[model samples]
Target: MTKPQIVWLRRDLRIEDQAALRAAAEAGPVIPVFVLDDETPGERRLGSASRWWLHGSLQELGDALNARGSRLILRRGSAAQVVSLLADEVGAGAIHTIRHYEPWWVKAEQDIAKRVDLVLHDGNYLLPPGCVVTGAGTPYRIFTPFYRAAMAHMPPPAPTSAPHFHAPARWPASDRLDDWKLRPTRPDWATGFVEVWTPGEAGATERLKDFLDVAAEYETTRNLPSQEGSSRLSPHLHWGEISPATVWHALDGRQGKGSESFRSELFWRDFAQNVITQFPDYPDRSFRPEFEKFRWRDPAKDENAKADLKAWRQGRTGYPIVDAGMRQLWRTGWMHNRVRMIAASFLIKHLLIDWRSGERWFWDTLVDADYGNNATNWQWVSGSGVDAALFTRIMAPLTQSAKFDAAEYIREWVPELADLTDEDIHDPPNRPRGYPDQLIGHREARERALSGYRAMKAS
Candidate 1:
């Protein structure tokens, strides 16, 4: 009688091209499990938007496992304890799982290693974090050098085929997914999400194929928020529904500026993981220690700051592009990358609010709210991370809107500006009715931000 091999699922939810899942199945009869371990990362636990995506992704995973004459064993508890208990119950010979970079996950893996023969494989990234580094054996602090070094490692491993598991004589006990309450019910703000995204391996595959067809134009059209120029694979990738290796291989040998540009963006994603792996506290703190001295406004202490934050969140900031991006994020659990920068800059620089505040909001709202990417990008916008944007380089939202030609995007999300002319969409000659007034003049805000940065330097 063959002993069961347990495949402990975390973010790597898919079967195809899954390193750990394939390795587990090849060992003997495979028993797959997903543990909802909220205890590992208390405050960093899955936010409402991520929970919504997880609910659907897990359902799809369960269905796929069932068709293969196996079913996913769902359990809720501390992962270290639950996985250890499961391994004992099944008398498993080995446990296989992909490497995860999240600080909590790092801890859980450490805890789980004591009980079973844990086999960690790489799947979540094109190359696992810490694999690429400077010639001096240190992780690259800047993206350009990192990108150059990472690309040389080139084209991740050729994806492996999905495995066919041999089932044990009897299946182990499992929990009902619905009992976990991963989705919301009181007010379904996620209703628009279903229309915009399909969170599963199959859906991700389809999206990848669709994007590849138009990928040749990605370089020119990606910045235009109204166009479907992007792969829209961030959520899928975040959940590991599709492995980065698969994406790399799919676009392999494809030639176009868009393909190259998209691949570079993937490099950026890898860069974020590299950053957070070395700096575990990257999510809540600045990478550059000097940024600790920077003066940032607090909504908790000032009424005006509080109101500015509220307007930014509610999409009434009176900046067309920024407001549209916020509203898009609210309605669909996603936002355009270009507008993400604009909106983040407005909050951090224009409003003088702490980038952490905007980071927390995005953490709660984005379906693809990855801690590494979220933290690294937020810090980049706020000029607080390594090789970050300079503090004085405050982006003018109005100029960015016109440069990117986001007028159509604004019209779609900020309907009050629907009647404005294309030329005036970015900056209306007069404030439209029902639209809130600009919270602060651009020049005044710029000067104030500069003054704050200077004060930090002097101090």
Candidate 2:
């Protein structure tokens, strides 16, 4: 009898298109393990919304494995230590898992490899982070060149089917998923998440199918938050319930601006990973050193800044578009992509608060909050990333709301403005009965943001 192979699960939760699971199944009897190691990540541990999603994703994954006559071993502790002990107990041949780029996970992988025969497979992104390089063989930092080079290798490998394997001779003791307390209990904040999301492989497949119907119109409709223009697959993709390769293959042979535009967005996800690989602290630190000196209103010491931050978080910011985005994010663990930029910009520029504040808030609130994507996007909006827009290019929230036809979107999230006409919905002429006043006028906020930029330059 061959020794059992251990498949260590992480974000890549699905059985299908899972390189590690496939490799393990091919070798011999399989033992699937999911270690909820919060200690390793320390401050970067899974946020509240992510933890809630994990409960559902893990439950579905365990059921799927059980249906195949396999068991998912659950444990909590230091990942490196847990895996090593499990390897000893099961007499595992080798440990297989998809590569993760988060700084903590990268370090954890290195430590685990030192103790066991750990084999890392590349299946998370379209391509491995460092695969696409410039003419000089260095990783491309900017997106356009990277996109062009990556496109040259378009249409990623076809997704593989789920494999079958024998179960371990004697299964180890596993923890009950419910005992983990992953979901909220007292004052349950995630009531809306259940209605909006389905957290498993089946759910991911359903979402992909729905997106296909509108994929041809994606280019025109993607920016419009009012309609179901977006794929709503970010949470699924983030959890690895669906693989990018699967998504790519699904979109294959569909010719149109929508498909082309959607593919670029996928590549952008890859770009974000490439960025974090180069700068592990990208989430915490600005790429440009000058930004280190940029004077942001510190909520810690400034009472006004603190109040503004609270208003932004609670979605009470008077800007209908910004408030709608924030409220939507709070109600559902997600937000429209276009509005995400607007809300983030309002926090960083209009409120003159640190981008890190908004990033941290989203990290806790969003089910799809990914470290790489979150940091890259926040830095991009703040003009502090290697590839970023100018700080001077302040976005006018009212103008953007009207331009993108977000009246319906606003109405759905901010019910206070629901009765307003399309003409007045974007920027209510007066304070509505229940709605708060604009946090700050667009022109004043833009000027303030630009002034801060000038101050950073002079400093």
Top TM-score prediction, candidate number: 2
Spell out the clash pairs found in candidate 2: none
Per-residue alpha-carbon lDDT of candidate 1 for residues 1-459, written as tens digits (9 for 90 to 100) = 878999999989999999998988888999999999888888998899999999999999999998988889999999989999999998999899998999999988998898789999997887888888888999988999999888888878898888997888788888999999888898878998999998889999999999989898999999899898888999999999999889988987789898899999998888999988889899788877877888788899999999999999999888999999999999999999999999999999999999999999999999999989999999999999976899799999999999988989999999999999999999888988899888898999999999999998899
In candidate 1, residue 333 scores what lDDT?
96
Question: How many steric clashes between backbone atoms does each model show?
Answer: 0, 0
Count of clashing pairs, candidate 1: 0
How do the residues 172-237 of candidate 2 rate in per-residue lDDT, one tens digit apiece?
Answer: 889899989999999999999998999989899999999999999999999999999989999899
Which residue pairs overlap in candidate 1's backbone? none
* Local distance difference test values of all predictions, in order: 0.91, 0.93
TM-scores for the candidates: 0.98, 0.99
RMSD of each: 1.0, 0.8
